[model samples]
Target chain A: MSVQHVKIVKNVLAGNDQTAERNRARFNAAGVLAVNVIAAPGAGKTSLIVKTMAALGARARVGVIEGDIAGSIDTEKVLAAGACDAVQINTGGNCHLEAGMVQRALDDLDLDRLDIVFVENVGNLVCPTHWALGEQLKLCLPSTAEGHDKPIKYPEIFAVSDVIVLNKIDLSELVDFDRDFFYKAVRALNSHAPIFEISCRTGAGLSAWADWLLNQHPHLDTKTERLHHLSGAPGM
Target chain B: MHELSIASYLLESVEAQAQELGAQRVLAINLVAGERAGIVDDALQFSFDLLTPETLAEGAHINVRRTFMRFHCAPCDCEYSPKVGNFSCPDCGAVGQLTADGTELLIESIEIET
Candidate 1:
């Protein structure tokens, strides 16, 4: 028996990362700001999307991509909440949404008509942090009810997230969430991103959240923006 | 579930590399992962076992070595792991940042038989 050793240093996720870059290029071509929303189950991802869409109104053209383990319930809600268009991606049984799956979903959405696309990632903190879907921003939601130590337990997710959304603060009175501990822990993981504390059930802190969304995509304010509604360009 | 996906990528890359070298089958592979890489070794092995059935990498052994998260505390100029779970320097208990030592996931080498 003859054997040989071949040495190669390559990232195991190279294929996925390359595909994500392609997805990002596609989104850029249409001037769509893509946001990947990740969180643990029941972290209020869908509620935030719904509220953001309603708040943006005519301020921005928004599309929704609902990712679930199996079902179209979130898609139905986004459509009802007035998303310019929406795409539903069911992971079947996967714990997370990979770049290839996001690529396939992008084919169905009219990216030219949208300013920002929010991908509601399949609820799982650990798995979703590894995959990138060519998104310009990654939003991570950790409900205060879920406890403050989440940033420590799942540090990788918070470390990579661009925006940390603290949801369900409406129950801060009832729940024993330590605000100082959570911020300090999150700072250990990530120090640059702004942490937004909001209650999706009430409009307590959504104005600032929506304002932050607008700042992410400044093209909405520029007249030079290649808007599908204002221009004759077709969706790529 | 993520391991299964990772194993698929590893197998595909190994098979492609093996074929390029005119090898008929692959025997084993060495994978190096850093402390912050966030992968489970047993889960990766289990997925590799189930995924290599019909590929050129069938029956191949996968060896995963994890490089622990290393940090250097500047406050006391000490180097250690995050003992307190938040970059708390083990030597002097000062907060530090993630070092480059154990943050990468790499496919080191592969063995194949002709």
Candidate 2:
């Protein structure tokens, strides 16, 4: 029997990537900015989203796709907050939401009418990082109680994130989190992404985080910003 | 968890590639798994062994190799491969940026016959 060797140096997720591109194109056509939020369980990802919405006030309309292993608790919470386009995706048992999963969720919603769609990935640090959900921005939440070692412990997730939020900052003094050490560790993996320290409970420092979130979508520039520049004002 | 799905994608990709080339049988397939990819080698192998029986890669041998994480050291002006949980460079001890070589999940090759 004659056998031949073929060189196929292609990613195993080539098919997945193709599907993600389709999702990206669809999102672009609908003019929706999708951000994928990843973190471990109890990292307060949902609370952050809610506070972000509250911080944005009436200036922005937010859409959420909450991914959980079983319950629709997060969906209920966000919907009660008056988000018009909230969708709950129960992974059933999957630890992450793949690109195809996000694609299906997009089909069910009128993403065109919303300004931002945040896909709260299933609360697994490791699995969720590997799957790209066609998101333009990726936010990783590492709470103060989770310790500073998390960046080094889960380097892959931290390194891949576009923005890192140090949640539970109100408990930062209570918890023994080393701010200097955490900054150094996170910079080692991702030197470019800005790390925001905020507390969802007290609503302190959420304004800066909200500004960053709004700045992510170039199309969402406020009229005040445009007028300020037109009037030759220094800055806000 | 995701490894099982990755394993299925691997099989489907190689089988489709082989069939596109009009290859009748597959002898072996090679995969490169990154240390940071969070995939279990044994689990991926188990999936391959269980699912390939009805396809062109039914009896194909699966080989998975793990690669080290690559870190760019700006001060050192070079790149160093480091193990997970330790980002320090062996020589200069500087960890600047992370390269994607370690998270790669690729189908390196497949052996087949016409």
Candidate 3:
């Protein structure tokens, strides 16, 4: 077999990046602090976000954009948990939520009346991390049942996460989960991220996490004062 | 794996590049796959072969350049390669704090026969 040489080129999908940038600008303009919550199946992402919305409901207005391959249970749960508004995006069979999907979902949310908007990504660590949904914070949920080596095994997801939530800590002792090993794994991939050990079922260690999230309000940033100029009315 | 999507992107890029260079058929495509990217080389190649047929890149060879994961010590400023599944800075024992060099999935170059 003869080897044939071809041209070399480096070009990313500029269209996707442009859409993400526009989403970011729109989110900033609406003073909506969006977060992309990612994790594996059975990681308690919905439970954690529901608990967070309940805890922060009195302090701040919260909205939710639930992305799932099928079923509206998460959307119903978010509404029942007392979010100002909740919308669901069904990706059919897609493993992750893309920027275009999020843009469509944004039209269904009232951007002005919310202080925080959480995009609960589809439960798969690999696919979600590759897609940017215009969220300022990228949160990862690693349940104790998933083992301590997840951060090392799936380094890309952990690397992009601004915060790591170690969920199902209530069962830490029942299982052979080692806190030190998990911490070491996370630190190896991401050192600056603050890891919150919480139990969504018991509502343990959630207040501190909620407080940290509240502090990330766009209005709190002096450099971006324009974020606070949003009207209280719903945009969508 | 997500490598299927990356392969699709590569095929699109190669087709576009071939059109830009006024070439009718693509011969090979070069890609860099970092060790930490979680992509299976055999799986990607299989998917690429299956997906590229009947397209402009039919029967194109795929060349993957593997790069090892490297981290820098924050305190000592020493760069070190991490052993597979090991993520610590060997020089300062400061943990892996530097940005990762691996985990890259990009189309580097494409060859086309005019």
**Docking quality level of the chain pair in candidate 1:** medium
Steric collisions counted per model = 0, 0, 3
Model 2 lDDT per residue over A137-191, tens place: 9999999999988988888899889999889988977988899888887888888
- Chain B TM, every candidate: 0.90, 0.80, 0.84
Model 3: which residue pairs collide?
A6-B111, A7-B110, A8-B109
Q: What share of the true interface contacts does each candidate keep?
A: 0.71, 0.85, 0.47
Arrange candidates by TM-score, descending: 1, 2, 3
Question: Which 10 successive residues of model 3 chain B have the least lDDT summed?
Answer: B91-100
Compared with the true structure, what per-residue lDDT tens digits does model 1 show for residues A56-100? 777778898889999999999988889889889988889999999
Candidate 1 vs candidate 3, DockQ winner: 1
DockQ of each: 0.69, 0.69, 0.47
**Model 3 vs truth, CA RMSD:** 3.8
Regions of candidate 3 where Cα sits further than 4 Å from its true position: A1-8, A11-15, A220-236, B73-78, B89-94
Which ten residues in a row are the worst by lDDT in model 1 chain A?
Answer: A220-229
Worst 10 residues of 2 chain A by lDDT: A219-228
Clashing pairs in 1: none
lDDT of each: 0.86, 0.85, 0.81
